[model samples]
Target: MTHTWALVNLKPGVGKSTTAVFAAQAAYEEGLKPLLVDADDGRSCLAAYNRADGFKWPVIGLAEPDLHRKLPDLDGGVDLVIIDVPQVEDHARIARGALRYADTWIVPVAPSHYEVDRMFEPPRGAADDSGRYRLLEFFEEVQDMRRSPADVVVSLNRTNRAKRTKTGPDAEVREALEDKGFEVLNTVIPWHDDRFRQAILPRTPGTNMRRLVRELLDRKGATQ
Candidate 1:
C-alpha cells in the first residue's frame, strides 16, 4: 500500500523538516521506496538529506508546495513520500494541498503554550462553540482530510522530560486531541542540539529520529 504524509502546520520553529526527513527515511528503512518531498523553499530538509549520508532511499526535493498540480507520479514507484511544508500565515493552503494526496497528516507540536495554540488555531476555528466544552471533538470532525476516515496525529516534539508539570500546555493539548480518539505518538522527540545540527545534513534518520518514527509507525497499542 502506498502512503503519502505531510508534516505541516501554521506554527513555525516546530521541527517540521526534521519530522518530514526522518519519517520518509523510516519508510525507506522498512523496505519501501520512500520519496522525500521538500515543499518549503528553505531547502533545509534537502540539505539534511544530502548531508546525513548512507541513505538507502530516494528523497526528492520539491521547492513548490502545491502537490495537487505539481506531483507528477505517486503510484508508479513511490510507496511513500514525506513532505516538509512551509510554516506561514496561510500554510493551511499548502497543507490542504498536501492533504489532497496524503494518507496521513502529522502536525508536530512543540511542547509549549504558544506552539500548541498556534498549531491548534486553524482547526479550532472550524469548531462549533459548544460552550468551549467538547470543542476538540468538533475540531476533529472538521479536520478530517478524507471522508473515508482521516488519521490526523498530533505529535509532541521538542519535549523536555526533565521538566515536570502535570497540567501544563503540553498535557492539556494532548488531552484534547486524545479525547477525540486521535492516535497520538508516544515517543516525544527531545529538544537537542544534535537534532537541529543534523537538520542541515541529509541522508538517513539518526537513532533518536528512528526511534520516534517507530513510535509513529508502530501498532496502535503494541510496545516498541
Candidate 2:
C-alpha cells in the first residue's frame, strides 16, 4: 500500500512547497519510490520540478479539489506520495481535499507568533466574524471528515541555530503548538536561503532535512 503525506498550513510562505520537495527528495534517498503531487494553484512545486536538471521523482499538477478520488489514478506505483497543499485561507477546497486524502499530515510553521496568528485567519467573508484567519479551526474541522485521526505533525521551519536552542522563537512556537495539543516534530529546518529558499537541484539534502525525513520514516515504520 502506498503512503501519502500532505504538507498543509493555513497561510502560504511557511515552507509548504519546500518541505514537500525536500521530503520527496529525502524519501527517494531512503530507497522508496516517491511521487510529488502539487495540489496548490500556485504551481510552485511544478515549477521547481520543471527547472531542475534531473528531479528525483515524478511531479504532477492536480490543483483540483477531489484529490482523494484523483490521487489513486496518479500514484504511478510509487510507495509514497507527498502533496503540497495550498494555504487554507484562499484555497480551502483544495486544501481540504488534500487533507482528506493523505494518511499523514505535516503542518510547516515558522517560529513566529505572527505566523501562528495567520494560520487562524478565516476565509474571506467567513461568518466566523472573528476577523482572523480560520485556518487552525478549519484544519480541526477537516479531521472529522477523515476516516481516522491522521498522523499529524507540526514542523518548525526556517529557524536559526540560536532560536532552536533552549529558549527562543523555536521553543516558543513549539510550546504554543504543544499547548494546542499538536505533535511538533523534533527536526527543525534551519534558515538557509541559498539552500532552501529558491532551491535548485543537484544539491544534497541538508542535515536538518535529512533528519526530518528519517524521523518521518521512523514514524511511518512504527505505525506499520
Candidate 3:
C-alpha cells in the first residue's frame, strides 16, 4: 500500500522541507519507492534533488493550490509520497490541498517556548479572522474535510540532546503538545550541523533520522 504524508507547519523555517527530504531518503534506503512532492513555492526539496548527484527517488514541484486533485495522476507506482507543504499562515489553499490528500501529517517543530507559542498564533492577514488559520484549528477543519482522520504526529527537530534531561525544554514542549492533544513521535532529531542544517541529500543521514523514518513507517503500518 502506498502512504502519503504531508510535512506541515504554521510558520516557515521549521524544518518541514528538510524533514521531507530526509524522510524520503530514509524510506528509499529501507527499500521503499518514495515520491517527494515539493508543494511549497520555495521549491527547496525540488532544488535539493536537482543539486544531488544520485538520488534514489524522484521529486517534483507542485506548488499549485489544487495539489490534492493533481497528485493522484503522478503516483507513479511509488510506495510513499511525502509532501513538503507550504506554511498555513501564508498559503492556506496549498496547505489545505496537501492536508486533504495525505493520510499522515508530520509537523516538525523545534524545542523552544517561542516555537510552541507560534503554533497557535492566528495567521497573518484576514480582516475578520476567527482563528481558523491557527495550526491546530486549521487541522480541525482539514479533518472534517477528510473521509477518514489522518494520523497527525509531531516530530521534534533541531533539539539539543545534551540538554534534554528530565526537566528540559524539549520535555516541556513535548508535554505541552500532548496536553493539547497531539501524538508526539518518540524520535527526536538532534542538532547536527553536518546532517540537518546543510543542503539535503547526497550525504548519509545520522541515526536519529533513520529512526524517525522507521517510526513514521511504523505509525503508517499501524493505521493500515
Every model's TM-score: 0.71, 0.90, 0.91
lDDT of each: 0.63, 0.83, 0.85
Residue 32, model 2: Cα distance from true site in angstroms: 1.3
lDDT digits (tens) for residues 7-67 of candidate 2: 9987788899988888888888878899999998889989898888559689989999999
Best first by TM-score, ranked: 3, 2, 1
Model 1: per-residue lDDT, tens digit, 1-224? Answer: 55666786665677888777766666666667877777776787767766766366666666554675676465467776787867644454665566666656677877766665555453444453433422243334335644554456767777775242357766666676666455667666667766454454433456555666665555422422
- As for lDDT, the candidate ahead, 1 or 3, is 3
Task: Please provide, for model 3 over 11-87, each residue's C-alpha lDDT reduced to its tens digit, 9 standing for 90 to 100.
Answer: 99999988888888888888889999999999888788877854888888899888889998888699999999999
Indicate which candidate wins on lDDT: 3
Clashes of each: 7, 7, 0
RMSDs, each prediction?
5.0, 2.5, 2.7
Best by TM-score: 3
In model 1, the runs with Cα more than 4 Å from the true position are: 51-55, 63-66, 69-72, 122-147, 162-173, 176-183, 199-208, 219-224
